[model samples]
Every structure is written in structure tokens, then in C-alpha cells.
Target chain A: MRKSTAPIISIADVKNVLGKQVVHEHLNLDIMKGEITAIVGGSGCGKTTLLRNILMLLRPKSGSIKIFDIDILHCDIKTSQKIRHSWGVLFQHGALFSALTVLENVQFPLRTFTTLPPKVQKEIALLKITMSGLPLEAAFKYPSELSGGMLKRAALARAIVMDPELLFLDEPTSGLDPQSAGAFDELLLDLKEGLGLTVVMVTHDLSSLAHVSDKVVFLGEKKVLAALPLQELLKQKHPLIQAYFSGSRGESYVKSA
Target chain B: MNNQQPAQLSFDKNTHTLHCSGSWTVSAISDFLKQPPLTTNKTNRIQIEGGGISRMDTTGAWALHQQANALKKSGKTISFSGFSEEHTALFQMVEAALPEKQPRPKSSRKPSFLYVLGKKSVDRYFSLLNGLAFLGEVIVFFGRIIMRPARLQYKSFLNVIDETGYRAIAIVGLLSFLIGIVLAYQSGQQLKTYGANIYIISLIGIAMLQEFGPLITAIIVAGRTSSAFTAQIGTMQLNEEIDALRTMGVSPVIRLVIPKILGLIISLPLLIILADICGVLGGMLVADKMLNISYYSFLLNFPNMIQLQTLLNGLIKGPFFACIIAGVGCYQGFQVVSSADSVGRKTTKSVVQSIFLIIVADALFSIILPWQSV
Candidate 1:
């Protein structure tokens, strides 16, 4: 696949201090349009924090961050809402509304943001639900009725129901079995290619990193250690980057690279 | 600043094509869908010219599909022209997944009166069955706890007592006290007119002890403690903590429900006693202010007119009311199957059921006990 050089998200010299601790300092990163970027880190290494910063969910102490060429830090509420409408977020636990069935959950944003007639909305929602690899019967079931993999699929359906240009997934494959996780990665790739979506995912799953990530950003020591393609990032001389893939489990990815 | 032009379709006469134009994204399609975009009335073979379309999304694709289907229904053969690769892929994906015609969502129309009555009766019958099953379990576990006291969850039992008993004192006392004051004021007016102002003691005392004291305490606790019990237990069930207890060879009833049952059984009577005292004190204050009756005179008259049996008659219902509240609350908690939605719904049902049962029990108490004090 040919990679686009156009920057979809750019963070310049960002500083994030949460309470008494410095989570990230001088963190500069760029995510290109149409690339699947993975933010990988150790536990408490602030993968979610960086994702939150770029998502405009957290205010860094200092920096300029841009998404779709618009300055996210200084934008007003209306502009922020427009930015929000253009992107989709899938939380770690598949945060579907408990009361609504999967179909209703997928249709929620469409109903809220669009003036589409309900009939067309249902058609679009059903389309997304099918594209997410869920059975049509799953649409009528509530979130609590779904198993782990089904929950993820339902959440992914809701996320992309708007046909968002950008998709954010947190630990998308964390709870699924390996086969299901691999299938999820394949689904992610299919979505990114078919929908022309730019993906930014926070995941520890090396399989996901190897399978789908077009670019990898390794976070450590309160900043981005390196941001490169998967094969290229594996060659980094930095001890932290090396240690990230030096574990008995991680070595398999490094060796495969 | 999304200043994109809304999508539009223009008809061309010579080629028999509908020229699709402008931004066809979801944000812009709102105004386009208001008026039907098809004007292929004359043409037998209509072509959609897509080169003029600047932007499109899944919503746009779906809209086009719908418009195309409409044209096809009128016996017009439709084809796409100048379509980009992305648009074609989206169109194909939407078409592949789209059901020919989706069934409309189930209507929320009201059912017939007989249907509602039958459904409600069946629902109530099941609730009664569940209540009986839950009551049987509680009795069995209560016997076990009495046989071996060490098996009881003493820490949780103390916690429940502290929560249901000590924490609830203020609201229960204040509400019943207000009721007492209102009672004294209402009856004092009639007593003063009859030149028997001091009879306000018997009027307020008998009413407070025989009816309002225990009844008010049960309702307040049902609102407060019963709802809390239901919510706490329902959330535990939702989180599978109750399941965790069961897996560990611990009975959820002995550990969770019994503590609440014992605590409320012990605390509610204590609360009723506190409410009774506060109720009388409020009545005494109102009598002093409104009827020229001193606190000393009110206290002296209390022993003469208000018999011990009147006090016992109201106080006796406390444990029974507590059983109703705790039983209904815990039963509803057990009924939560899966969702946080069920927890919320069950919590509401618990409070309603507990209060309703408490009222029924109060009515039975009045019927069984004679009106005259022994």
C-alpha cells in the first residue's frame, strides 16, 4: 500500500504534567493520513495519556496539536464538536450504552448529529453492523448479551457508523482470544482500507502491531522514544525500544521482523 | 467551518441522465433529502452522473442507493457514470449488506386492556413465586445462623446495621416529628372549640403510636434503606461479586442478604421508637404553643390517656415491616440477571414493592388488633 505523506495529526513539543508526576514532556509526534498508527508502551507509560492529549480529551501543560490541519488546543467548542463529529473513538471495554441494543447504539450518533430520516439511518446502521463482521441478529441484542469478541465488534460498528475519517481504538484486541484478535486486526485493516480511515490505536498486542500498524510510536521515559514503521522501529538501538521487544514473548515479533 | 454545498441532482433532457452534484457527505445531505432527488419520470434508461459530486460518505452512498431504488421501482433502468473508485467501493459495500427492505422497528402502541391485565397478573404471579422461594431460603439460612452463629457474616452485619440504623436516624426522626406537629395542630383546633384542649394528648399520642409512627418509619426506611439494599446487592450481582461468593462455597444469602435482613429487623424497631419519641415531642411542642398546654402537663397526661398497649400495637409491626422491606429489596436484587439497566429497574421495583407490602401489612395489623387500648 502506498503511504500518504500528508500529516493528519501533528503534536509539537507537547508537555503533559498530571498532578505531581510528569507523564510526557517534549513529546513530538506526527501521524500521517491513511496510516494505521500504533502507540505501544509499558503499563502506566502513558499510552492512553498521549492518545487523550491528541484526542483533545486532556490539556497538555504546553504544546500545539493539530488534527486535520486544525489547531486542536486553541479551538472553540463548536470547532471541537466538528472535529469530534469527523472522528470515532472505541474505548477499551466497548463502552456501548447498556440500555440500547447494538443497532440502536450504532444509530445513536447518526440520530443525534444528522437529519437523516430514521429509515435511511437504519439502513446505514445495518450496513455498518454487517461491515463490522457481526450477524444481523446480534443487532437486536443488548450490549450485556454480547460475549467479549461480539462486544468489540458491536463497539467497532458504532464507532464507524458515521463513516468517520479518523478512528481511535484503545486496546481493541486485549480481551479476545488469539484467533479472534487476529480476525479483529484483519477487520481493522479492512475498515481502514475500505472506509479510507486513518487509525490511531493504543495496544500492547505485538501481533496487532505486526499485522496492521503502518507506523509505530514507542512511548517511554515520559516521551516518544521513536516513531517509525514496524520493521524499522524493531532496529532502533535505544535500550528501552530494544527491551520492549526483547522479552521472550516480544522476541517473536522482533525475530519475525 | 464546513461550508460545503449541499448535494443536488439536476436532470438533463438530451442524455436522459440525472447529474449528481455538490458535497454529498452526511453533514450536507440534510437539505438534499427533504425534496426527492429523482426526476427520471420520462426516461426509460436513466444514468446518474457522479463526476460533479465533490464528497460522499456511507450516508451519501445509502441516500444514492435509496434514490436509485426509487427510480428502478418506476421501471427506469439506472446506471452510474464518472464514479470514483472510493465511491464505487462504498456503493458496493452498502449494496452488499443492505436488506431489500428492512422491517420497521417494533411499535410501542398500547395493547388491549385484557392483554395488559393478563400480562400484569402473570407478572405478579411470578413475582409472588419468586418471593416465596426467596423467603424459604432466608428461613433456612436464618435457622443455620441460629444453629451456628459463627457462620454469620458479623462484620457485614455490623456494617448493615450501621448503614440502615445509625445513618437513617435523622431523616426518619425529622419526618415523623413533622407529621406529629401537623397532627397536634389539626386536632387541637377541634379540641379547643370543644373546651377539652387537653384531649390533644390522647388524640395525637394514640394516632402517632397506633398508626403513624411505625407506618411512617417503614415507608421512610423503604425509601431509604430498602432502596440502598437493592442497589448495593444488584450492583454486586451485576459485577458477579455475588457469583464469586457462591463459587467460594459461601451462601450469598448468609453473607449478603441475612446481614441486611437482620440489620433492618433490629434497626427498624429502634428507628420506630426514636420516631415515636420525636413524634410525641413535636406534638408536645405544638400543644404548648397552640393550646396553652405546658410540656409538664402533656407528659403527665400521656400516662393517663395513652395506654402501653397502644404503644405496643404500633411498635410490634416494626420487625414485620422490616422483614417486608429487607425481603423485597433483597429479592429484587437477586432478580437482576445481567445489565446495569436491570440493576436500575430492579432497584425501582424493590422500593415500590417494599412500600406496597408495608402498607398492606399495616392494614392487616389494624384489622387484627382491636381499636380500643387494653
Candidate 2:
């Protein structure tokens, strides 16, 4: 990652959640323009909470978040919408339209964000569907008919339908089989190179972090513990990192890595 | 390696045994009901083999009773021969609690078709009367529209026109033509006996303008446009698209419901007009060909039978039917639960309820219109 490429996303001294309970506090992070970052942690470590905060889905009680050098908190509604359009999100469970065919699901963002004609819209949807490694035959089938893997691919197709600059994937490989998950990692790598996308993925899938992530952020101890390359993460003396990397849970991942 | 397959169950020339296994619960009762019936040969007797039965509950006893009932239905002897002591005790307890089946008395009188129709009419009379409740909802919806005109968006009006009006042209036209032909054939047959076959034009023209034109068009719109709106909105709700719209600072009612209501309101009258023309043309074609009536005389009589009040009545029904369609469609869509099956159920209900409301509204109009004029 080039240091000269000023951070596209910067979270500064953020404290989030309300009431007497604080979910996360005193968090500071900077994500570079064109790099893939993986947020990895155990369950209830508030990794998802942090991503939601950055996405402005949740407001911080203190401090600020800047995306593409624009303060997300202070931006007007139109500017916020514009900023959101620039980023694509792949929710857990793929969140594809159960009623719509895969092709229409992929066409959703394109239809919402652009004034492209129906034929052009269809062509763009088909291209993204193809890029996701799903066949043309699967395009007209509903999400219910798709297997878990195909649903993820279709969702990925939708996420990139508008050729978004930043892509956010929450637990992309969580429910996929080992082989399908490996294939998904390869697809993400291909997309990262092909589309020049800056990806921020939240995952418990250690195998994904080892194979695809340029940098991994381990959220622990009420803050981000370390954001480093896989090699560096492996060598770290952090007890939580060591515990996560040295067990039956980490064995398959170590082998894949 | 041994490649032989395991032995399958056999239904020989004697009693057949069905082995029941697994933990039986209320949730699994449906699956248990779907089990294939046991077959037997010369002596059609079904014997339960309960050796492998691991767990039994109230649902299991009910399933056993259902199985026995099926065997009895098939004219076979059924017995629970191999039940464990525990299973036997459970069955006895259940049998004691079961209600006695009442014998249905055979009716001596074979009711006529008209009698059956009259009975159904009586039974459905309350349902027909209860449909008046929808008018209160309609009044409330219109009251909201009038009170908060700003809530109704121009885009929604265009959307409603597109969905209800533009999408329904071909279907309404086709059905209207078919109805016209049927009306011509029936009226021609009647009028021929009196040597007045030319009167088919007046019959079809009056019917189309006053009743069939509005009613048939409304029914078709209910089935097509209302169901589409429900399914579209229901699916959006399921996919959290509606929630997303709310989060993004857009009111779902304004974005979704407004367009559908506007479209249906604008389209229904136009569609009725088109149906009216098509129905008349269909009648004219049949009158000239099948009835050997002169087209010019038929056309001359057609206008004399159709008054401006009749045309206005048909046009007036459009907005009312549109409101009914939109209200029912929006109500059903909002009622959609978070599942694909619920979406389908809501879509079906939207169409059924919309058509039912349309008919009820027509009845009310028929009763009140003469009173209003007086």
C-alpha cells in the first residue's frame, strides 16, 4: 500500500453506543485508498459494531468518521446518499431479493443509481453475474432456488453492479463449504485486482484472512489490537492472537494458509 | 466388497407390517401423514410393527389413527399387532379421549341446482353484507388523501397509471371482446325466436355501458394490477428494501403506495372505456354475421340505448374501484409477514379482496344511485 495515498476512511478517537454501557471506546483507525483490509476477531468483540460505525449505520457518541476526506457525520442527506452510492455492501446471508431473479437482483443498484436503459442495464447485470463465476442459466432463477454459494456470488454481483469504489463484505465465507469458501477467496482476489476496489471485509474465517487480506485488524480489549499482514499477525505475541491461531479452530486455516 | 443391496419391504399374500421409528412430535405430524400407505394381498390387513419405535407422543397416536382410518377407507383390516406395552397403553388412553363419530343422515330430497344456489346465497349473505365495512376504510383513505394532499406525490400518480393502466390494456381488450361475443350469441338466440335479432346491439350496448363494462374491467384490474402491487410491495418488505427506503429518508407509502393508487385511478376509467368499445364492436360483428342484422341499423339503435348518465355511471365506478384496488393491495402488502409463502398468500388475498370489494361497491351504487337522483 502506498503511504502517499491518503486514507480513504479515517475513524478518529471514536466512542460508540449509549446508556451507561459503552460498546467500544477510544478507537482510531485509517484505511488506505486501494488496499484489502480484514477485520478479524472472536464473537462479541464488537468488530461488526465498528464496521457499522464506519458505515454511519450507527452514530458515535464522540469523535468523527471521514470517508474519502468528507466528514460523514456532518454531510448533508444528498451528500450522504452520494457517499453511500460510492460504496457497496454485501450483508451477511447475501440478503438478495427472494422474489427477484438473480439478474434483477444484480440490476438493483444499477437501476437505483443510474439512468441506464433496460438493455444496457441487463448487459451490465449479466457481466457482473459472469464475473462472479455464476453461469448465465442461473441469472433468471430466484434466490430461493440458489444454493448458499451461488447466493453469495449473486450478492457479490449486486454489490459491484454499480462498479463501486469501496466494497464492504460482512462474513462472506461464514456459511460456505470449504471448497466454495476457497473459491470465494480467489474470486475476491480477482475482483480486487480487476476492479481496483478497496475492500473492507469482516470475517471470522481465518482461512480468508491468510489467503486474501493485505492487512488484518484484530478487534480486542475494547479497541483495535493490531492491523498487520498475515505473516506479521502470525509472529505477534498477543495472547488473544496466539489463542486464536493455535487451536482446532485455527488448524484448517493454518493448513490453507 | 459386498455389492448386494439391503432387502426391501414386501407385501405378500398375507398381513403387511409397517415399521414406525423416530421421535414423534406435533411438528413432525405433517410428515408422518405423508407416509405411503402399507399394502397387502389376498387378506388386506395392515399390522403395525412397533419394535423400532423409539419415542411416541400424542401426535404419534393421531398418526396411527389416521393410518388406521386410511386402511378402513381402502376396505382393509387394520390392527396394531406388534405395539410395545407402553405403546398399547398410550393408544388406549388416546382412544378413550377421542370423540365419537356422528352418523351423517342421508337426505331424502336431491336438491335442485336453484335450491343449492339459494342455500349458498343465504350462507354468503352475511359475508356479502360485511363487505360494506370496506367502505368505511375507503372513506378513511380518501379522507387522508384530501386532508394531506402533499403526501400524495405526482410520481406515484404516474406510477399507478403505468402499473394499472398501461399494463392492463391487452388483457381487458381481449376479455371485453370475448364477453361481447358471448352476449351476442345468447341475446341473438333469444331475439331470433321473436324475429328481433337486431335488438342484440341494444342489449350488449346497454349492458356494456351500465354494468359489464365497469364490473368486468374492475375485476380484471383487481386480478392484474392489485395483485402486482401487493406482490411487489410484499417482496420489497421481505428484502428489507422498504425498511432501507425509510432509513434513507424516503417514506415507503409516498414512494410505493402513491404510484400504485394514482396509476389505478387514472387507468381504470380508460380501461372501462376501451372495454366498452370492444364489447360493442364484438356484439356488432356477431349481430351482422350470425344474426344477419344490418350494421347501420344496429349502430343507430346502439346510441339510443346508451344515455350520458349510463356512460357517466361507468366512468364514476372507475375511481371507486381504483380506490378499492389500491386500498386492498396496499393493506395486503403491509400485512405481508417475512417469508416467500406469506408474500404469495398476501398477493392472492389482495386480488380476492379487491374483486369482492368491487362487486359490493357496485351493489351499493345500484341501490343508492336511483335514491340520489330522486
Worst 10 residues of 2 chain A by lDDT: A115-124
Q: Where does model 2 exceed 4 Å of error?
A: A1-5, A18-20, B1-341, B344-374
lDDT tens readout by residue for model 1, A95-144: 89999999999999999998888876787888888877788878888999
- Report, in order, each candidate's fnat: 0.43, 0.03
Residue-by-residue lDDT tens digits, candidate 1, B30-79: 78787875655677998898999888777788889989989888888989
lDDT of 1 at B368: 96
lDDT of 2 at A181: 89
Who wins the TM-score comparison? Answer: 1
Cα lDDT tens digits for candidate 2, A1-257: 22336888998888877566686788888888778999988788888888888788888888889998889999999888878877888888888987788989998876776554555466556666766777777888888778878898899889876656689999999888898788789867655654456899999888788889998988887778888888888789999988878889787777667
lDDT for position A181 in model 1 = 89
Model 1 ranges off by over 4 Å: A1-6, A12-26, A52-65, A69-74, A175-183, A238-240, A246-249, A253-257, B15-17, B37-47, B68-79, B100-125, B369-374
Model 2: which residue pairs collide? B156-B259, B160-B259, B160-B263, B161-B263
As a whole number from 0 to 100, the lDDT of residue B309 in candidate 2 is 78
